[model samples]
Target: MKFLQIAAIAAALSALTFGCQKKAEKKASYPPTPATLVKAEGKSVRKYIDTLGTISSLHSVNIVPQVSGQIVKINFEQGQFVKEGDVLAEIDPRPYAAAVMQAEGNLRQAEAQLKIDALDVERNRKLAKDNYVDKQTFDSLLAKVEVDKGVVETCKAALETARINLDWCKIKSPISGKVGLYNINSGNVVAAGTSVITTIEQLDRLYVDFVVPSQRLYDVKRFMEANGGKAAVDVSYIEDDLGHRKTVAEVDIILNKIRYESGTAVLRGRLDNKDGLFWPNQPVKVRVNLEEIKGAVLIPNMCIQIGPKEPFVYIAAPYKDGVYVISQRDVGEGQLFDGGMRAVSGVKDGEMVVKSVSSLRLQAGPFVYAATPEGLIMGADSKPILDPAKMREFMSNATAIADELRAKFAKEAAEAAAKKQAPVEALKAAEKAAAGE
Candidate 1:
């Protein structure tokens, strides 16, 4: 009885296994999946190199006192826009003024002595000519006149020096720009040429400084030469969270010297910041356009699939019952393009490519159909109609695929027609014999 029970259990397990196998086989015979199809198209594209860079003021100046003095007045507030030669601060001018006066007094004394010496030389010359004075005395008087002229010139130089010192008392801006914070306040003593009073930077036009490998400098220069001594550059500020960049300006790029330590060359971009969108020393994204690809074949990056050795895409050909024959063609892929498109070499213009709903389910030569929204209709409820424009585009893609398939099989179609006609002619001859024709 125990042996009979074991035999019954084994029979029941065998029946269950057989039932599961039949169900799985039924599920595997379903129809092919549908996919979104798009066409490869030609577009104008540009090649660019992306790098990080720093924004800076094109022109910056450090304001310092040319002469040491106590600051008596401050003329500019921090962060004020100033013009060239605008007075910024005032130093005490009393000492310089006194020096000017003393030099002028010395100049007058020298002039007076020069006049007396000249008169004495003229009188001695006249006496020597009449033999009343010796030639040596006349020569001595002429030498005295020359010495007086030298004293006058020395006094004049002293006066000019004093005047320059007095001018320095009023510190002025050397360039037109916005001023930074003041380092010293009024009544503070500053050292000549060493103390930092403030800083001014020109912001109407800005510079973006970036570095790239030295090998790329040649490409930069070649691009510039082709595009009128300037390569196109874009400056952008990046948002860290979303990884998006906001372009601040489009500018021209200038190539600079290479640094041997890092084997990188510095590049400077001149950006017009008349709107003050960018700030100095701010980090930004820099993109330099190296070259342009004309008539480039472009397709969405999603359409490209990796094959055993190269990248490939699925070319869709129209098949029976609104389905497509997906054939894989190897492609040479280039740089990433705008709008998530990639440049490819193997595909021609206007070829339909499949967009997979689930990339993992996609494989070479898998059957597919065009996706539509007809299933949205329900009983006793209104459904959203297909967009007219989108429907037209879908129909157009189907027509294109059909046309391509027809052209590809044109020779075979002629051969099939000949075969069909030959059989029909044979039947006609047999019918004529029966009719005694």
Candidate 2:
């Protein structure tokens, strides 16, 4: 019986110890953690889809000689811009000029023969009417006149062809564009319709070709239809600043067919490059604004804390006792916005979120100290009113106060030391007087 009683006492002691430990742990409290905080605000957000594009010329021509001849004069420099019908090069026109003269002479001879035949036909008709010529002979004379008239018409066509060939000796630009390197220089014999003189590319108005995912085709079409059947896009070189947004022409056919390999479709945009900033086959960036979201709740990207389940942020609020506390609030993250911010759904507008904390350790209802742009504003509905000038003013005033305090403390320490030393010296002098006595 005594052994059983001792066992019961031991069990009681063990339970008591466990209870005390639990109480001590429960009573422990963490100090207020210092955290950098940002405010969630509502604003107009523009959604944009970005992709790489290539600049291409709408018109690219490989200039070829229309007539075979030796180049007598190279009228244009390599890489010079020329307008349509501008003379680019001059082939040896002397031969073509001589050919034109010869054709003209042939035409004149045919016309003179036709005139003589007509006069003979008139005389033959009179002879036949007067019975001075047989009917068969008159018919033969009329046939000769008709044949001569046919010869004259053929000669006129030949003369026109000769003139056209002569004009082609002066090679002209087929389109207004910048010319590439000369393939055939002066004194080089070019084959008609075969040898390439040079290449011309129209750069004033350029085409930019890009690809968009097949998923976005519907949105692109819908947006375009709502906005005058034209999807406004912008194209800029990779090195250009994104501040200025330029407009791009809508493609007549938007992604005519989907690419099976990449699940993308080709989109072509036209840009007017009056400044000659764009070039053919040049790599560029394209931006297409799809839609706008009004009253978007945005927060800094760094504020979101990812967990095993979902992403969340620390909501810093204050208790009725004037002590600020932080609670973890789960958030549904949306697409990223400008300025490294993200659109979030859980947090309301004007809500304070912990952007950065001194320690990564976080818990529910933990005490927190909030730092903000607006002179250390604290609590739940508080937002950091960002004013650079105000922040500078606050820093200057704080620095001045610190310097004054430091100087006052130094002076007080010096006075205290002097007082202590005088008492010690006076005591030593009194002891010396007693020794003398």
**lDDT digits (tens) for residues 1-437 of candidate 1:** 22223323433344345567865553112233456777799988888777889989989999999999899999999999999999999999999999999999999999999999999987777789998988888888889999999999999999999999999999999999999998999999999999999999999888888887788778877888887887777777855563454444444555445688999888777888877778899888777888988999999998888878988887876575455767778899987865899899989888888766444333211445666333321111223326777545545554555444433343344455579799999999999999999
Off by over 4 Å in 2: 1-27, 126-140, 240-253, 304-314, 317-333, 357-360, 364-367, 372-437
Best by TM-score: 1
The TM-score obtained by model 1 is 0.74
Candidate 2: minimum summed lDDT over ten consecutive residues — where?
A: 1-10
Residue-level lDDT tens digits of model 2 in 276-368:
777899888788777888998999999998878989887876433224456678899987866889999999999878888754433211445
Error of 2 at 422 (Å): 76
TM-score of each: 0.74, 0.72
